[model samples]
Target: MPIQPQAAKYKPESPILSLGEKIGDPVHAADFPKAILRFRNDRWAEAVGLDHLNDDQWVQHFGRFQPLEGTLQQPLALRYHGHQFRVYNPDIGDGRGFLFAQLRDHAGRLLDLGTKGSGQTPYSRFGDGRLTLKGGVREILATEMLEALGVNSSKTFSLVETGEDLIRGDEPSPTRSSVLVRLSHSHIRIGTFQRIALEQNSELMTRLVDYCLTNLLQPAPEGVAPPIALMRQAVENTAELAASFMVAGFVHGVLNSDNINITGESFDYGPWRFTPHWEPGFTAAYFDQTGLYAFGRQAEAIHWDVAQLAVSLRLLCEAEPLIAELEHFPALYQDSLITHFFRRIGLTPGEREASLQFIESCVQAMAQTGTEIDRFFFDWRCGDPRSPARYAGEAWDKVRMEAAAFLPAGTRDHPYWTDDAPCSMHIEEVEALWSAIADRDDWEPLNQKVEAIRRMGEAHQPRLT
Candidate 1:
C-alpha cells in the first residue's frame, strides 16, 4: 500500500532560531537506498494538516531527507549537553536525529517533526547514527499506550523500514534498520537550558527563557520575571506529567535531563515499560542496574530533572526564587496524582481529600492482592458491581461507594463499561506482537493491536457532565 500525500493546510515555523548558536550544523538523512513505509499516523497527520501527502512525497520528505512543503529547507541537528545518569556528559546531542520541521496544530500549538535513525550529525560520535526497526516499533507501541492512557506523550508520526541489517549488542544481531519521525509539542529540553548554562551564556539563557515564555508557555502575570515564571510552569507541568506516568503504570526507563522536554510532554520513548503488578521496583531498561528509574521512583526522578532545570535557570535568576518554585513540585505532584487518577477512573471531580483517600485505598488494595494495574481500573471503572470484592474491604468499599455517586449519568450505560477487560500493553503481549513481525514478517498483529488500543482510547474518552 502506497502512502498518498494530503493537502497541507498549516505552514511551518522555526522559532527555535531565536536562540542563536544554540542549534548546530545542518545534516542530511542517510540515503538508506531503500524506503519501506511501515507505519503512517494519518489520524495525527489530519490534525496537523498533512494527511494529503502521497507515498512518494512521504518517502522523499521523511525517508530521503527532502524538505516538506513549506517546511524547513534543511534539518537542523540540535546541540545540547545532558546528564545520562546524574553524570554530566558533554558529548550528547541529536546524533541520529534532527529537527526536521515545525508546524502548528488545529489549536495553534507549536509542534516539531523530529527524526530518529535519520542519519549521523556532528553529535554522532563513535556510533553509526541509525535506529533499529525493533526500537522504532517499541517506540510506536509506547507512545500509543501512553496517549491512550491520557498521558501527554509524543506521537510516532511515521516509520520507514530502511532496508539494512544492523548489529546490536542489546538485541539479536543483524536486526533490521528503520527511521522514525516523532511529532512532539516541542523539542526544547531541560538539557537545552543546561547547555547554555554550561557555556555561561546568561544572555542566551535569558533569550531562551523569553522565547519559551512567549511561545511554549502561558502568559505570565504582570511583574513576574520570565525565568521565574518559566520555572514555575515547568514545575507544575512536569509534576502533572509525572503523575500521569504513575497513573498509567509506565516506567520511562531513562529520565535523563535531555529526555525531559521543557514543555513537560513525554517524548523519547526508549526502554519504557508498563508495570505488570504495581511493583515499585519494576524497571524497564536492562541497564538500569541501580533502579534509579524504577516504577516507584519516577516522581523522584522527574523532580531531580526539574531541579536541574532550576539550576540552569539560576544563570538568569536568583537561587532563592528558583528554590521556592522547586519546593512546589512535591505538593503539585500529589495533587496532580489525585486529579489524574480520578480522571482515569471515569469519576467526576471530588473533594481533594476524598480523592486522595480513594487513591490511597485503591493502592493499598492493589498492593495487598497483587491485582493487575490495568485490570483493576477496567473492572472497577464507574464502580462496576462485577468487579472483584475480595480486595474491597471496608475502607475501599466506602471509597467505591463515594466514587459511584460521582459517576456521570451519561456513562452509566456506555457499552465500553461492559467489556471483559481493558486494553493493556503488557511485556508478554508486546513480545508476542514483535515475535510475529520478526519470525514471519507479519504485520497484521501489530496493526490489530494498535486498532484495539485506539478503540480503548475512544472508550476511555471522558464523558462530559
Candidate 2:
C-alpha cells in the first residue's frame, strides 16, 4: 500500500521560550525547487499529535519550516557553545537546523520538533547548511535500528528529498539533498547551559535551571536546589543512555557536549556504527584517530560530557554536591548495562554479580567465536535450545541454566524468534540499502528492512520501562 499523510492535528506548547534571549534565532528554510516526501513516521506522529497532516501539509511544515498552529511564529535556531573533541568552540549552535515547534506526547511529556538541513543559520560558519540524501537515509536507518534494540532514541519523524545538488569533499560531488525532522524529548544540550555559564549570566542560568527542572526533570525534593536535582537526573539519565548504547552494540562516533542532550535520548546520528564483535577499539567516525569515542570508551565519553554539564551547573550551586552526583555514574552505568543486557537477551533480571558474570561470559563467547553481535543475542535469546552446540560450552551452560529458569513460556511461539537470521544494521548492509536507492531508485529494500526491524522490535514485547 502506498503511504499517505493524513490532516494536521497539532497541539503546540513552548517551554524553552523561557530562555528568552538564549532561545534561538529566527530562520527560514531554503527555497528548494522540490519537496519530495521520502519518509513519514506516522506511528510516532500519532503519539505527538501530528498524525493528521496530509502529504502537502507535511512538506509545508517539515520541508519549509512552516510553524504549526499555536506554535512558535518563526523557527528558532538555538544558540549554544560546545566542546567539540575536548576543545571549547563558542561559534557553535544550530548551524543548519532549528527548533521548529514543541508539542506534548500522549503521556504529557514535552517533545521538540527539531530540524536538520533546514538552511544556513548564524552558526553555519562558512559552509552551506544542507544535509546529503545519504546522510538522511543513514540517520533513518540508525534511529530505526537503535529503537528496535530498545535504546532510548529520537524518532526520524520526517525525511523529505529537497531538490538540490550539493558539492562535498567527502562524498561524490552533486549528491542529492534532504531535510530531516527529528522528534525528541528535548533539543537542549549541556552546551546550552555552558553558554550561559561562559557569559557569567547567573540570573539567566538560574532561570534556565529552573525551567529545565519544571519542564523536563521529575519533581525534586522539598528543599534541594533545582541545579542539584537536575545534575543528579542528568547523571543517571546519561549513564543509562551510555549503557543502552553499549548493550545495543552501537558506537556514536561523536560524543561532544553539544551532541549530548540533557533529556538523555540519543539523537544526532552522524558517524555511528554497530559492532561486529567484542572489539573495544571499534571507532565509528573515521577522524576519531584517538579512539576517544570508541565502542569501549563510549561510557567514558558520556561521563566526560556529563561532568561538563556538572561544571556548568556549578554556576548555580556548590561543587561538592555536583561532584557527589558525578560519582554515581559508574555504579549507575554498570547497573543499567546489566539490566539492559538482560532485557536485550530476553532474560529476567538476576543477581547483580551473576548478571555481570553472564555478560562477561557472553562477551568472551562472542570474542572466541567471532559471531555477529545481533546474531548472538538472537540465538541465545530466552536461552533458545537451537543455539549452536559450540555455544553450549561450560561457561555458556551456566548462563543457559540461569536464563532458562526465567525464560517466558511462549518464547518460541513468536515468528520473529524462529527466523534463521537476526536483523542487523552493519555498515555493509547500510551501504547496500543506500546503493539500491541511489543506483536503482529502488526504495523497496529500505522499506522491507524497516518492516523487518519493526517486527523484531514487536517480538521483544514491553520495551524497557
Best by lDDT: 2
Residue 106 CA displacement from its true place in model 2, Å: 1.1
lDDT of candidate 2 over 122-145, digit per residue (tens): 999996999999999999999888
Would you estimate the TM-scores of all the predictions? 0.95, 0.95
Model 2 misses residue 132 by how many Å? 0.2
- In angstroms, how far off is 227's CA in candidate 1? 0.2
Q: Which residues of candidate 1, in runs, are more than 4 Å off?
A: 1-8, 388-414, 462-465
Summarize candidate 1's per-residue lDDT along 145-236 as a digit string, tens digits.
88877888889999999998998988898999999999988888999899989999988888888888888888777898888899999999
